[model samples]
Target: MSGYEKTVLLTGATGFIGGRLLLRLLDQGIKVRCLVRSAKKFEAMFPGLDGVEVMEGDPARGSGLSEAMQGVEVAYYLIHSMGSARQKGRGFIEQDRKAAENFRIAGEKAGIERVIYLSGLGEHQKELSKHLSSRQEVGKILASGSIRTTELRAGVIIGSGGAGFEIIRYLVERLPLMIAPMWVNTRCQPIAVSNVMDYLLGCLTTPETAGRILEICGPEVLSYRELILCYANIRRLKRAILSVPVLTPKLSAYWVQLITPVPNGVVRPLIEGLKNEVVCRDNSIRELIPVELIPMKEAICTALTEVEKGPGGIPSRQSCFLHSLT
Candidate 1:
């Protein structure tokens, strides 16, 4: 590989967005080193892949991160603890802070040039949900170090297999008659998973994105209710969503836990985070990376296709698997 070619380190390579991003990078012939908690899981998720290195590490544990950063040019911090039990105690934030600090120190020692982070879209330094606030704080921590950082803030990503999309899918597929919280009216500008991948890959080629924060979203902005209605339309399902203002975040989270199989730990943060509008506040990323953003319906269709593919397939549609809401 040329010197200009980035030897990238990717955290959360086994995750939904990370998996897609990894495939894109590999297709581009970019060298990649993935930090995974389990080598077996990594191999199972990405079997028979070439031109990639899988290093054993858990970012939350500060383990194996140093080795993963060795000789890496760019590192993508994509790890989150929404699914973990520790999230109940708001431990994800501390874990993320530690991970960011560790990665920064390790990357600095390894001479890494840049760190690219995918974070949630929300107001910074405010009363944001623990999840969103932690994401924002992690970006700040990464930028404070010697390695310059690029933070891409985005709303719920509409892609197959991603948690947010799964929630949308479950609500639409399982609940023909839906009782939703008032947050359903909260606005969001969701980007298709493909467009997000495009922008992430664009970061690899564009040197200008380093040390900057880019807010990204699709061309259309819609309410969470509208998103669900649109998804229902794509699936050709007749759905009715009744938003009840009395459903507190806690109650909504419990409902999600019971109905969607999403654990309370995960559902709570997502529910709380939903209280804030997540539309794109800036268009700097578009100026930097020009790709035709796909429409929401097309994005939903693509995600659904991946979901229908099931395991051992190319995720033909985004995974719509709901966590056991039991």
Candidate 2:
């Protein structure tokens, strides 16, 4: 590689977004180093993976980060503790905090140029859920470092194998009728995985994106109920939902776990987030990156066939999503 060529460090390279981002960066012939806990597991998960260096380290534990940050021009902090903060207790929050602190220290010492972080989209002034609040906290910790940081705050990313997408798919496909929580009426801006990918890559090449917290989302803003109905329409499945005032977050999670394959632990935090109106307040990023924001209907249709099975260790129910409807 030329001396001027950029080398990137991708944390959380094995996740739904990070895995696909890895392939995209590789396709562009970029020099990439992925920080993984076990090289053996990484190799097994991404068989025949090439053109990228694998560094065995756990970001959560703040291990091997200094070496990973070496010679890296930019780094992607895609790491997030996805477990429920309230249900799982303080462990998840602490993990996220430690990782961010370590990463900031490492990147600054190593003279990294930019850090791109995918953070949850929720207004800080509002009473944010534990999940969204934790994400925002991570973003703050990263930005405090000397390195320029670009935080992309996104709401429900509609994609196959993604936890958010999987939940919607199960709720719409399995249940023809749902007496859902009042949060179902909450407004959110959902983006397609492709659009999210484009924006992330755009931030890498676009210098102006550095040190900016941009809200990246689809062109359309939709309510949770409309999003479900949109999925049902695409599948040609008959689904009905009644917005009920009775279901608490815990109860909603239990109901979801009962019908969907998603575990109660994962379901609770997500359900808690549903109460917040996560619609994008800022649209300035569109001018900066200029990506075509896919509509709700088109995004859902494309995601239905994006992946049947989970790749890079993220759980998926897409394989059985259609089967259960019949």
Candidate 3:
């Protein structure tokens, strides 16, 4: 039903954001080719979804990228090295750099037109966590490539099955009272997963957004403690957080691992990232691609509603009514 239809290559089709984006692209009747590590897994996930071609490959390994990117007009780079860095003992910074380089080289060789990347929202002036730093660095590497690139950065994405949101949900639901690190005082602008998908899909039609780093977030800005308390309120639970300066990042990560389903490696980097304030600096993207941004409470409600329906039952952006920015 939308006008912008072209051959697109999605790198992280199996990821949380990428999966949602893939559904929207299909809803718009766009032809998409996905580069995934396993075609069988992708097929199993989507079942009978038509009009999507899956190519087996790993961007981190630099395998099957060119073949997957052939004739692709727009390529969405949503791949990250967080899990590999944390679990496999690989340097996340180096892994991300290598992946971006591989993607850049492949895109240039294939003559791809545009690159859309989702990164973290953090101020460059302040010291950032390795996870956030690596995200920004990947965006830079992708932009430096031959193809035009549009980078969208967000903070604390709240959605069902999302690591950040799940971590928060687990912490609040499992613990009525918590001893948190000082970083709990750090401020962040959380965004809804559906709104993030809207921005990603809208970028395809809006040409001016190319070569720009757009910071997309929810309308409200709240501290980490406030976010947790808000979630507690929504669940009608009395939660109290005691923030202490003595708790180091490592100790906080260990605490998180014990309290939630999040792994130690994953929570360490994520906990470290909370040290810096990650609020939006430039909101110009609001004017460029205007979509109704969901508030934090509504976003949490949506995520919780999806969780009530099991993981497979979680709806995509295409199934829900989305406002058109074009």
Per-residue lDDT of candidate 2, residues 189-245 (tens digit): 999998999999888888899999999889888899998987776677788999879
| Model 3: CA > 4 A from native | 85-88, 311-326
Each model's lDDT? 0.82, 0.83, 0.86
Write one digit per residue (lDDT tens) for candidate 3, span 171-220. Answer: 88788789988989999999999999989998999999998999999999
Off by over 4 Å in 1: 1-4, 85-90, 311-326
Candidate number of the best TM-score:
3
Which pairs clash inside model 2? Answer: none
Q: How close is candidate 2 to the true structure, as a TM-score?
A: 0.90
Q: Positional deviation of 252 in candidate 1, in angstroms? A: 0.9
Q: Whose TM-score is higher: candidate 2's or candidate 3's?
A: 3
Model 2 clash number: 0
Reference-based lDDT, residue 184, model 3: 90
Using all chains and alpha carbons, the TM-scores for the candidates as numbered come to 0.91, 0.90, 0.93
Which pairs clash inside model 3? Answer: none
